[model samples]
Target: MLSIIYYFVFNIFIGDYIKYSCIVPADASFQVYRDNFIFFVKVFYYFRYFLFCFIIVIRLFYVKNKFFRWLIKKICYFA
Candidate 1:
């Protein structure tokens, strides 16, 4: 829902650049940019998910033992 609104607002602001230029407003270029933007967004979404999962996993490990704390410390040291 938010993305749809963003797309509309974004196009409203930027559409003229593409529409008025010598470049053809063909479906191929539109789809290419659309797919690239979607892929970039998805990558960030997955990264956030991965970070959330990592935090949860670390929390669980911390709950398990002092050894896990040491392990995390070591990992952080190298990280």
Candidate 2:
């Protein structure tokens, strides 16, 4: 429920961002930035999952680098 509301608000914000950022009117705006928007949307979704993999890579790196492993354990102590 909360996440749904957040998406609703985020969508409104994105709409306003695209609206004021472009010189074109809302109706023709889609045609104006179609290809560019599609490319960025794809890259955005691609990196969404990439971020998770990047975090796993960080953990993997710590497993091999004993110095960073201890440093994080001491500085980033958590439950």
Candidate 3:
């Protein structure tokens, strides 16, 4: 779907799209940077994979078109 493709593309170029600002507090410790990196990795992992798949499955299940749902189910079974 276009949503999946767009999200994947966004993830691919996110590193370039987002720039690191060099502002820091004087009292901030090194652990803050490590924590931020961990959070970033978690977001990248969950958003690109789990989050969208969950949304799509929920949307498909809620659709009123039985034929379309059946088609997707068949395709997913083989995929």
Candidate 4:
């Protein structure tokens, strides 16, 4: 969870930088910028989902502690 928050915060800053650097001229419409932003957001969403599933599988199969298993269940309840 900490890593996910960090990853998103880092990407948000990077995305802002990219948008600032890639701004179009005053004569141009902002559709291209909008499309690029959407694309990046979708990519990030899919990547995060994949990472979450991978972590869940790893924890379920590899971790052996009864307390840890209970913690996972509690986490899932919140999720």
For residues 12-53, write the lDDT of model 1, one tens digit per residue: 534544344335344875877766655655565445456656
Task: Compose the digit string of candidate 2's lDDT tens values, residues 1-79.
Answer: 8546545544555555455555544575576576576455555545535665666657766687788777767755672
C-alpha lDDT (0 to 100) for residue 35 of candidate 1? 60
Off by over 4 Å in 3: 1-18, 21-46
Task: Report lDDT per candidate.
Answer: 0.60, 0.59, 0.65, 0.67
Candidate 2: stretches off by over 4 Å? 1-32, 64-79
Q: Over the stretch 1-79, how does candidate 3's per-residue lDDT look in tens digits?
A: 8787766565655544333322333345856875676577557655666766877887987799998799889988998
Native-to-model Cα distance after best TM-score fit, residue 37 in candidate 3, in Å: 3.7
The estimated TM-scores of all candidates read: 0.47, 0.38, 0.39, 0.43
Model 4: ten consecutive residues of lowest lDDT: 19-28
Clashing pairs in 2: none
Better of 1 and 3 by lDDT: 3
- TM-score of candidate 4 against the unseen true structure: 0.43
How many steric overlaps are in each model, in order? Answer: 0, 0, 0, 0
Instruction: Encode model 4's per-residue lDDT on 1-79: one tens digit a residue.
Output: 8777757664676566555644544334776766677677667656756877876767685678878778777886898
Using TM-score as the measure, the top candidate is: 1
In angstroms, the error of model 3 at 58 is 2.0
Pick the winner on TM-score between candidates 2 and 4.
4
Top candidate (lDDT): 4
